[model samples]
Target chain A: MPPKPQNLKNPIIWFFASLIVLWAAPLFLPTFYVYLITEILIVSLFAVSTNVLLGFTGLLSFGQVAFFGSSAYAVSLLIKGTSLPFAASFFISVGMSALAALIIGLFCMRLRGFYFAILTLAFSQIFFVVVYKWTSLTGGDDGIVGIPKKPFLFFNINGPDAYYHFVLLVVMVSLALLYLIIRSPLGEVLQAIRDNSERTEFLGLQVRNYRLASFVIAGTFGGVAGALFAPFQGIVTPELLHWSHSAEPLMISLLGGMYFFFGPIAGAVIFVFIKEWITGFTEYWMFWYGLLLMLLIMYLPGGIMGFVSEHLKRGKDDSR
Target chain B: MEFSYFIYQLIIGLSYSMLLFLIASGLTIIFGLLNIPNFAHGALYMLGAYFTYFFLHSLPGVSFGIALVLAVVSVGLIGAFLEYVPLRKIYERSHALQLLMTFSFILILDDATKYFAGTDFLSIAIPKLMDGSITLPGDREMPVYSIFIIACGLVVAYLLWLGLYKTRLGKLVQAGTANKEMLSALGINVPRLFTLVFILGSVLAGLGGGLAGPLKAVSVGMGETVIITIFAIVIVGGVGSLKGAFIASILVGELNTFGVVFFPSFAMAFTYILVIVVLLTKPEGLFRTK
Candidate 1:
């Protein structure tokens, strides 16, 4: 049973159609759903950003929160401490994340596999410690409270609906940009590195530089997500920077299907909803969640998108 | 700083270092042979403490020594199950999957412990026999339990070195660590050996946890805290090098002790700083037995 050639037309249309629906969703939905969708959008962006490293570049970093949490804190500080506008704060925080990624990635690029993972975890833990112990500056464990949703440029994104719309716009644009990166020539080299870095190097590519580029891209967008998250949540805490929190984006990327561009988006949707539903019933949701993740890894290592695409292919074959 | 005060801190740091070596030795052993960095290794350590607490409380008149042994054995059995079940399926998978699988174990084990032990920090009392302290010169006093921990670490290190170098099975383990395929081609039951090594590793973690119980507040999050430090020791020492783990543990322990004295505000960042520096300078570690 040879596989049939796939059609790309339907997916492109579906992508745009879904975007339109998402763009207009807050208007028809209730306030609660508006908040949930905003959360999903932010999480999806973060997961997608992380997947650039994990799935695309074949690097598993456990320190992404260094970028995300730092950006969140930076944005929160800028918005509260200074009279800077929201847009200025957002770009500054994201730029800060890119700089951090460059510095960290320079050192981290030398290692591969488990060493890379551990080194990243250690570096991120440094962020966690600094954030946790710098009590006078970061408020320590008490965290920064009452971070208001400042106006983005002319629009007053102070209310839930306005903020939801603002997040939706930013996330959609970010996702579009990430999609472009994944489809670019640089993206091709990254995927080549993912499949076989040694072979790609023999083809005369600078593997370390490409890896650093991917790391910076991921960190910048992760910062984008974090910047948006600070105003949305109205608070920031050191826990956001902890190594454990770094697992969330990676898990989301794995859950959705790492290979696909939209896998993490699907994962974020399901993850947020499942988490909300589970936490509603039991305080010990992590037990069930861990059990679910274990089962998924054992049986469905391909994740939701992989499973769905496989079934769709099977269905096409059967019809043929 | 006073010379006596520095010596007291040195001794205190040595005790912490020895306890770290106990847990890290198990982690390095499992990693050496099994090639799986067991993220749940810390959770197993936590379980050891919890199980010791459980046995000591539930059975009236059981001594701490007996309870610690029982806890270690129980943890070993759990380790066996882990090796046989979920872990067995992922031996040939990518490092990402292996790490995620082991990480899942941490979540399951930690949550299960939280459900059983409650979230409050629980303290285990020092045994009546080792409860007292010895006063040194300059009026510095050190707990007998800390001294016991240091002694236990030295004894275990010697025994592990002997077992690894002196015994036939130990030679096979060393061979397997260097080349698993050749060992498998030569008709060794690699899987069974992996299970045995995993059990051995778990027992060591459990012992470390049980020993650490009297010193620190035993809580669900204790594993998460120590696991990172243990990882730093393993990486700095070079993974699977027992001698490296021992020296690195001492380095980390002493650096931390002195770091607090010299740079109190930045004390928490010292170990991570060491990790970054070591990783940057020598990613393979200070010692590479493999």
Candidate 2:
């Protein structure tokens, strides 16, 4: 009998396999490694959510931080101020993001390309300014501090290890949901719009409505990540709302392979490690990082996953 | 507010508007031709201020005018290098890539500046020629530098208008902005024109920075603080319209000034609100050029 090829190409199997490994990872790893992985997972979720718009829908937004930051702030405030359950606070924060996205998307969807990017940026800056100047409500630049990691649905997820497990499970479920979303018909329609909105509109689909849907979807998931981030960090700041901070996920998406579903995960791993490694040695890390980004944009626009997939295809072609 | 105070604030707002116009005009012109949003334009403006300060301090007995000229020229050279190098490779790429590429320049330039300039807020002195304030009828005082800035803005606007509309090169620029392929097909050197336009834009940004040094804090983060406001002006005016940038700059500058006085808490939000309002009403901008 001929040798059977490996089934590594199947993402579900890979997903479950990675989940098993990651779920067991904290058992062998130190508390620091566990915390680091938690951070990476949060960033990966954020990047993947952003990719839904940039990669799947072909929209380059500069205001995604608004959703993420607002949710972070909301979750933090609710945890600190009210007696609501963690789950309720989480849901409310994400819901607020969705509502915010809908309203902003309504205005922004009318514009395209550069105009869209600028309008979204303008809106996000409004959020930033509000967060920065609303000292009584937001604590202004000092940000909200000392946020407790309260119990969630009878689970004591307060310590670093417990929180890591909670984050891992939540991120995995979110990733799975996002994966299913991208694999569904809505995802196909979004991609179709990305490739050619005029053709999609010719098919009788309302392009603007679809874009708004994508925008809200991105914002909702971004809110989830933000909600996760607040408890993980034990604090939240207005810096989260800044437009410059919005670039992190976009850079991660681009670095990971915006086209691939698992690309940002790969990117998040590399990005976190690289940032850690670089910042360890030099304060001039931004200069080096900028240089890397420039080179990537210039020569490696397809990113790491794109490069890997292309080489794999070439190998298959050569064997054929 | 008292009438004299209102006039005083109005003049101050006009000076700020002129400075903003100088920066936005360059950005609009560069965008008009090169079709790339130069995120590093603000960085260049920062460099202009830094270089002017360096020139003034390093070269003893050097007048501020001499320092300003030298600083602008240096900025123009850097702009040329930027255009000839990384920016040149991305003309055929997507706007996302172009934006990222330009954004990288900001990171590089800002960090490089911090490495050399040491993260301090450096200030430049107003030239002796325009250092004092004039008293108005109601005992309100306005800085002479404010009047100088307003004059500089009007002169530059007039000169830019003349160059853009009255000169042959300006006509070529306008033609190129309208249709690059046609201009290139006509045997005009489009690449050279692009380089020239980019340099011109950079010089304007540099001049704005140098001129603003005496009025505002010159620091590493100054580029970032101004870039968003500059972008709002450009978009509000119309991406490629000089007149649009001018009008939008004035509107934003005055709104910010008055907002600060009447509604301090809402001041920061005013420019963004104006942007949202304009984009919602007229997606292309108020004075959209072709």
Candidate 3:
């Protein structure tokens, strides 16, 4: 008798169970901790979105944070400059990033592997420079501060817990959709391309189009996270566009497990918590981080999720 | 713009182009031969600059030339150690591991540099003989140091030409670049050739750093700044071609210098725009064989 994998048995039931647990987490946590969880949710979404290109499509984009930060800037400016609603600005920013992604992707997807990665970084750096130097418009290094936000109609969702719930809802929906995306035929096609791009091409699929689609999807999702970040944090900065910020998602995805559907989210949670814990003690967190990253790359190729998957596989093998 | 001033800026651009060529060529060779995208090349360059600065500053009467040579040699050795350490172990791994390890090296080297050199910017002293400016045909005075840099670049270029076209080792490296397994089958020690090529590549990068030390302010962020620009050069030049790297560097240097005169705010963006245009038209690079 073999045990059934819970994930495949009843995904809907599992989703609701997980959501209910997450929804009530704030109830047990202290009031000050709401901000922390909200941040985790945003970054986790960012990580998962990055995995779209990296894990599924096999394209390593180092400039993902360009979309994230640009979306943040766009949303922040839209809120301040126009009378648009939050939803409008959010979607608009995401749309802008996707459009930008298309433009950049058209040029970048011309190359494969290492060349593709560097080209993306180069493009992102260009954007970063623009945002940094355009002080008159983007506030340069000072960045735009005091960004205003409007709560949902008559809900008065001003409190931290209410905002947390709002963020949680957005994250849940985004993750659910992304999960569906990963489970669909489209997802299968992407994995096929990642596994053997030549064979996928030989199978009558346009590899470049799929890769470009992935770039746009990942960029749109990353933009959504950034859009959420600006209003959630009440600020937008040029640092968001920096190459280092782009590297964060890569680190998170790698750390959590690139193979697992939920790996990057787990990685992002671990990353934020580690950041919070380490920064509490020392300013040289980067040094420690480098050391940890070295060890992780050297020893833990599967990340935390990889480790879990290996154990699960071992259990299955033992049972059989 | 006045022709005289344009030529003056052009000379500055040329000198900087030479330095850029030195860095990009090394990276080109390493990428061609070893198949490892050595992200730490910039860090190695930065280390050379810091080394030269320290030696020159600490030993006041010591000549800048001696300091430069020592810096290049020492950093070359350090780069060899870097290759022997984590890089050798992960050569068989995925591109992800190679990239992560190199990135970790960047962080580690950056922090280590901060620990040793502190957070302050350091500059090299121009040698007394080359401290003066020389009068040009257009009645503009050009820095002798700039001319020296250009001369050094020409010398290195000529030497590289001789090495590649006239020497046994260069042929070995070139052959290895084409097919490592075939080169090994011909009874050559391919691993040693790889190590030697890596060392040579680092030495070239170090030389660029030494030359650049006196020109630019040495700082913590200099490595990353230079690396990105060099990446542009390497890409535009064609990944594995020295000729391409040389031409692209000059193009980039000129664009950066003169582009500022036209649009001061968008000077840097011009290089990236040029890069995008190149990627669109010639994805393999300007000098790619295929």
Candidate number achieving the greatest TM-score relative to the actual structure = 1
Candidate 3 has an lDDT of 0.84
How large an RMSD does model 3 have? 2.9
- Tens-digit lDDT track for model 2 on B87-112? 88889888877887888899899999
TM-score of chain A of 1: 0.96
Better of 2 and 3 by DockQ: 2
Order of candidates by TM-score, top first? Answer: 1, 2, 3
Q: Looking at model 1 chain A, which ten-residue stretch has the lowest summed lDDT?
A: A1-10
Best by DockQ: 2
The best candidate by lDDT is 1
Clashing pairs in 3: none
Q: Candidate 2 chain B — worst ten consecutive residues by lDDT sum?
A: B281-290
Model 1, stretches more than 4 Å misplaced?
A: A1-15
lDDT scores in order: 0.91, 0.90, 0.84
Local accuracy of candidate 3 as per-residue lDDT tens digits, B218-284: 9878888888788788888887777888889899988888888788988878877777777767867
TM-score of chain A of each: 0.96, 0.96, 0.94
The estimated TM-scores of all candidates read 0.97, 0.97, 0.94
DockQ of each: 0.75, 0.79, 0.51
